[model samples]
Target: MAKQRKIIHVDMDAFFASVEQRDHPEYKGKPLIVGGQPNSRGVVAACSYEARKYGIHSAMPCSRAYRLCSHALFVPPRFDAYREVSNQIRDIFWRYATEVEPLSLDEAYLDVTYTEAFNGSATLIAQAIKREILQETRLTASAGVSYNKFLAKIASDMDKPNGLYVIRPEQGEAFVAALPVGKFHGIGPATETKMHNLGIHTGKNLREKSLTELTERFGKAGQYYYNIARAIDERPVRSQRIRKSLGKETTFAEDIHSIPELTAKLLDLAERVFESLSKQNLKARTITVKVKYADFQQVTRAHSTEHIIQLTDLKQIIPLLLEKTEAGIKPVRLVGLSMSGFDVPVLQTHQPQLDLALNDEF
Candidate 1:
């Protein structure tokens, strides 16, 4: 029999808020919000547990959050500080696993199937890492241990604000079967609604549907659902996954209908994308512009050039792309710019085949 893989998923609890609380002792035990000023047109990036009590959460409007808890302290993000702490946490991950996949600044997956630590116990490894994170950063983290990325990621969220959970291979199927489809790591609200419409509220209900039926409804993602329902995910814990694209978007407080206003916003976004490309020492041949109308209708237009794109080219191309959308005819609520088709060589890996699907939830 082949050796079973052991994977551990670690996620810092309320990372931004925790860091803020730890750095400023005065904010400890108080409701804190991170991301924009309460009066500004911004959303919550992260909030402390105390803030959650009032129903304040990430991505919520800062204005709504203020209404919920007027006394809550609001602070802007400090990315440099977060990056420095992330490096410290990753250094600890390397001590226990050779394959460490960082999902973000505050979360990662570690494969320790062959390590000698704790007699190859993934649970012990998780505990040790959490202990070390607390000791070094004075912050708490939650961990999940399982045989695959899907299960491990789900297990990590079973508890919150500093918790650990594990799922063994023998228990994987039953555990998944009993779970709500919405609780699955990769499943999002839209998929959950579709599943519910099909009378598939739980994993067992999902498992009852044929792969063909699922694929017919969800396209390629159906196959992914079928396998995870059976506790089968063959995606490997990749150590070096290269990013294929980079982009950023901004939402306006009020909708704009004039071409000049839209062009000005696009200019700012283009500059931001160009700065990122320069910092990464990368160039691209494709530029995509995304526009969202006041009615919440969104459209994306892409322009490709034989030669690599330059900052000046973006400034010129954006105005042309805006014509593809009803930006001037209908008020626009958001505008974004992105670049891909990099000049750098791409990385390739021979991945194990099990399910060819992904979670668009994030």
Candidate 2:
């Protein structure tokens, strides 16, 4: 018999911002912006739902957000506090399932298909977990329950500030089909604009296009669009999935036309690339620059280096990599930097995750 799939995506409600409000009761019911200072060219970390009502959002310039909602309470980041709560929440997760994969400090996916709780319906488990979360954390979380990772992750966002949303198998594709194209996971501003220009303004519009049309329009993302539009996602809820690569991508709010501007963007991208990869010990041999033009056509340029890349090398070679693709790209809508082909260590490596998984075996 084919095993039934049961996955849950648990996302903390306004993780950082909520933590601040929880710690300081005065911050509750008021607009709060948490991150670096507004004058320091800082961006929004996370804002209270109250601030969201004022058009303030994460990643917005704190200065601009200030202009929009001057009364909003502003505070510097408290990573230490958030990290502490994150550990507690994770402990709560491990009690339910060992196959837990964290998307970030505040979100994770749990596949309870084979857990002791499996005999129960996913919705019942979802409710049980939600009640437990409220009791333990005194914080709200939104949950999505479904058969696969894709839908479950998206479903979790359906209800916010303490919600449990379930998409039963029967609803499946029909549910996704009813959603707007902009609603698909990862359809950021640039992709949304491209889809609108391509006459795919909603999920139904995207569905009307053939697989070939989507693939031609959005490159690799097109495949994801086609399948997810009909809720056909099959990806497993992988736990401690060895991250093969860590990379960063950027989408410009405005398209770039000039060489100097493009080059500067590339440098900025490289800096971000190095910053992200620097935190991990993973070493990679290839660096790839991904570009999407204003017209939505996408292409990549990759070069293999004999030695593993460091921040210095990434910054130094970014311009050269741009030059290699100079003939093909223009008026860029988005640009991304990625590295791959990690060199595996020979001897016994330290994967603390294996010990955790083994401990769960008994």
Candidate 3:
């Protein structure tokens, strides 16, 4: 028989807000929001647990969050500071297991199946890591221990604000069966509504459908849902995750109809995207622009070249790309810019092409 894998998913409690509270002790007990100003057209990046009590959450408009709690502290994100702390936390993960897959700056998955630490007790290792994090960084973390990545991730979220939950091998199916279908990790609001319409309210209800029935309904994702309903996820914890693309997007508080405003927004997004690309020392041959209409319709236009893309090239190309979209005809609510096609090395031999060609349709 194959050895069961021991996976642990660790997530920091209110990561960005907690870091702010730790750095600025006066903000400790108060409801804090980490994002843009209330008057700005920005969403909350992160909010403190205290803020959550007021119904404030990440991705909600800062203005809405302000209305929820006028007394809540609103502050911009300190990405540099957060990245530093995340590095510190990542160091702690490395001390326990070699197979660590970081889901984000605040959460990661660690496969400790073969780790001999603490007699290979995954729960003990989780406790030690949490204790060390508290001792070193004065921050609290939650951990979930299970035999697979999906269960481990769900277990981490079961208890919040410095909680540790475990799902044993024999108990996995029962635990999943009792869980609401909406609570499944991959099921979004739209998918949950679809499942509910089909009388699949919980894991048990989901497991009743055959593989063919699920596949016919959810396409490829149907198979995933069917397996997770039975607590079966065989995915490994991949440590080295290669980034495929870098992008930045903005959602306006009000829809914009002017072509000039849309072009300006696209330009700003391109600058931010290019800055991030430069920080990563990566180059791209393709640039994509996405526009979401006020009616919720979305479209994208892309351009590719034989040479590496530059900010100057983006400035010239964005206007032409925008003309292809219905932004001026339809009110645009969101605009995004992204750079991809980084598989080629920076020094790869390619004939310099002058023509700007629209190649990709994504």
User: What does candidate 2's lDDT look like per residue over 81-193, in tens digits?
Assistant: 98898888888887776478888889999877655663446676677777887787788889999888888988998988798888888887788878877777889888999
State each model's CA lDDT, in order: 0.89, 0.78, 0.89
Question: Distance (Å) between predicted and true CA of 231, model 2?
Answer: 1.1
lDDT of 3 by residue, 1-362 (tens): 34467889999999999999999999999999999888877889999999999999998879899999999999989999989999999999989885888989999999777666787788898999999999988999999999999999999999998999999898999999999998999999999999999999999999999999999999999899989999999988878776788999988988999988888998998888988888888899999999989777899999999899889997789989999999899999899999998854433222222322322110
Alpha carbon lDDT of residue 14, candidate 2?
91
* TM-score of structure candidate 1: 0.92
Please give the distance, in angstroms, between residue 251's alpha carbon in candidate 3 and its true position after superposition: 5.1
Task: Please give the range of 10 consecutive residues that has the lowest summed lDDT in model 3.
Answer: 353-362
- Model 1 lDDT, full chain set: 0.89
Tell me, by TM-score, which candidate is best.
Answer: 1
Better of 1 and 2 by TM-score: 1
Please, what's the RMSD in Å of model 1?
A: 5.0
TM-score of each: 0.92, 0.75, 0.88
